[model samples]
Target: MRDLDALDRRLIELLSREPRIGVLECSRRLGVARGTVQARLDRLQARGVIRGFGPDIDPAALGYTVTAFATLEIRQGRGRDVRAHLARIPEVLEMHTITGAGDMLCRIVARSNSDLQRVIDRVVDFDGIVRTSTVIALENPIPYRVLPLVTQDGKGLATPRDAARPQGEG
Candidate 1:
């Protein structure tokens, strides 16, 4: 990933606060030329720094209220096949190859505790999956975010475009 400068950070912050705002509106708010904003957005996208501009969805709001993390123990030399099988399951939201007692960890969701058991059964039913231990999430006091990373100061470094940003925009 390219090192984000002050201008990039501010642009991200502004867009995150108002995702529906247009590039021209962003240019006006940031006090930079429209082309500058357009160029920066293009560069950021090309560099894969900006993934996508899509609506964030809450699974719980969509009838999946129960959330659990499952740690799986796999049979030797079956990681690839197991991961492929897991990819087909929509309830498997995220997966990571982990160290320690488990070979992989998966974040899963379901409608209820009983529903979670069914999900778990489907996960372990696959060949090469030995065992799984799961922990139900009671609540989430802090959700996932990347804003602090975007807004971090890079030891006083600022891009030329940062000069055009309004005071307190940082």
Candidate 2:
């Protein structure tokens, strides 16, 4: 995607803060025309920058209090099969191919420690999976966030628009 301009940055920041805010409200808050705000949103979506506006849900709130990451070693020539197997299990939140000792990594959740073992057992039940290693998360000191990355330049400094704004203003 193309680089985000000052207006784009500000608009994204505003939207990220108040996802339920209406387009007219966004225009008023960002000091832009409603049409401009809509057009920017359209372009951002078309460019795949804004993936979705779905509500963010915590697995813990759903009674799946246990969170763990599993690194899987798949059999040769079974990557696709292993992915399909993982996808069939609802507990597998996400999986990714990584460049490391393991072939794939998965983020999973469970109701408890014993439930996690059951999830792991199901994960490795597929013949395509060779072995698995998992680690449980004790506490999430810093949850997932992307606002900082959105305002960061390639050199790890804040963009001019973000820098000009005073701290805690956005």
Candidate 3:
């Protein structure tokens, strides 16, 4: 595949904002034929520039008012082994391994503080996890944004052309 062009970068940025935008509509907005947009989208997907897309659900609206981030220090040599244990807990919405003092950062949604306690208990109950420090989300300042790629000089790269955004993003 060729290097990512301006159109490809533009497409990525647009998709990040509106993943469910239609191909035809995107072509219309970009002043290009629908086929051109489709081809670019396909290439982007094939090259792993675009992954999957889905809806963004509000945890609070779904009866979960408590949001917390859990920084977990796992027991030595058992990081990946904890997936099955963590998967059983429903309140754990997302888990990511980060570089820092902690091995994993877990995003949890709960009904209340007590519910968050339950989730934390579940996390600590796993034999593989050593310690967990949780930080409650008071307010999400930026929320989620599928960021545009940055160049070596720190300029944001655009995605393909606008296809509405792309499809299936949060």
Candidate 4:
């Protein structure tokens, strides 16, 4: 993974703000040639910097309002089975193996508090799971974001870009 130059940062900032913008529009906004914009986008995608342009869906809008985190302890050598079991449950949004008192942590969502219990039951129903603990999220003051990180200069400051030069030159 190479470092993102000034034009790359500016291009990313522009796309993050307007994901639906076409390459021509992006080139106009970024003051670069259309081919330049397309090339940069292609390179970013090829390098796996831009994962996908999928719609950002809200679970709350889909009637899954409640969110909770579950810390699970699985039986020895049952990690694969436990992971497969959790993956079959639709409520399991994401899971990670962490270094802590628990073996795995999962982010889950449900329709309500009562529905949360059912989700948790299904999560722990597998024979591979040994113990589990869960905590309900009351509020999310700061939702997920990556724009700041994307444009930062490694010193926690947004990098400045010079638009006059050709794109991807610097």
Candidate 5:
């Protein structure tokens, strides 16, 4: 957080809500100068305090009715290659290399169970993917939400990029 003051916290909260908000508008809302907002944003981004943000799309609205997570075990010496392979699959919305039983975890969406099967089977057929286990989600209790950087104690969990947690948001 680089000892972020209240103004910096306000800026991050505002940016998380709307990344494209103009600096002038942000300044007006925070009662700070546009240049000050710009400087804070630049520092935040440079120090990895704030990444990027965009819209959150609904899979159901997009006709993807099925959501699944696939746990994949890679062949020897092929973990990195397996991720690249899974990334090429259109259905794989998110991929993570977890520390649990699986080497890679993939989130996929499909229009139907058969479609989901096809997607997972494609991943299973990949060269480096040795085995796979899948958990088809019946419902998503919470979709996706970002973390609150500023804590209750008026402090932010300032972690470097390497220390940030994974997206195992179940």
Candidate 6:
């Protein structure tokens, strides 16, 4: 993995705060040269550090209020087949082959509880899947974030508090 320095973190922080900002704007905000910002962005993308500037959509805003995680137990040697089956379902937001009691854990969203049941049924309809357990999320007290990870510089990791602090402060 490539390590990120303070400059990289600052550049990412600036772009993340204002995704609409262009390379010239980023250079201004970060107080760096335009070509430097462009080059860094290009390098970040080439190294798979920065994936894309895609819009972040909220499922609740899209009328899919119900969020649930389904743990699936599938027949041995059929993990790949079960994954391909789940990939076809639009409601399956994310899927991972996990350890412990379940072979796979899938994050799904639905319109309602009844609709969630329908989605679950579709997941279980696969021939390789033997069992499944699902738990619905009532509320998200803390949503997902990557800024904390971005705060890290060199060998040190930054805490959430550190991210809130001004840059260059120990």
Which prediction has the highest lDDT against the true structure? Answer: 2
Q: What is the per-residue lDDT of model 2 for residues 1-170, given as tens digits with 9 covering 90 to 100?
A: 15787788778888888889999999998888999999999999999888878898999999999999999999999999999999999999999999899999999999999999999999999999988999999998767777767777656798787788666543
Clashes in predicted model 5: 0
Candidate 4: tens digits of C-alpha lDDT, residues 3-102: 7877888888888768888889999988999999899889989998988887888999999999999999999999999999999999999999998899
In the range 10-60, model 1's lDDT, one tens digit per residue, is 899898878899999999999999999999999999998888899988999
lDDT of 3 by residue, 16-126 (tens): 667789999888877789999999999888987777777778989999999999999998889778877888888889899899999999899999999888878988997
Ranked candidates (TM-score, high to low): 2, 6, 4, 1, 5, 3
lDDT pick, better of 2 and 5:
2
Better of 2 and 4 by lDDT: 2
lDDT of each: 0.87, 0.89, 0.77, 0.87, 0.77, 0.87
Q: Tell me the number of clashing residue pairs for each predicted model.
A: 0, 0, 20, 0, 0, 0
Q: Which ten residues in a row have the lowest lDDT in candidate 5?
A: 161-170
What's the TM-score of every candidate structure? 0.87, 0.91, 0.78, 0.88, 0.80, 0.91
| lDDT tens digits, residue span 5-98, model 5 | 7777677767766777899999999998989988998988888877765576788789999999988888889987887887788888999888
Model 2 has an lDDT value of: 0.89
TM-score of predicted structure 3: 0.78
* Candidate 2: count of backbone clashes, pairs at least 3 residues apart or interchain: 0
**Pairs of residues at least 3 apart in sequence or in different chains that clash in candidate 2:** none
Q: Which residue pairs clash in candidate 4?
A: none
State the TM-score for model 2. 0.91
Over 4 Å off, model 1: 155-170
TM-score of 1: 0.87
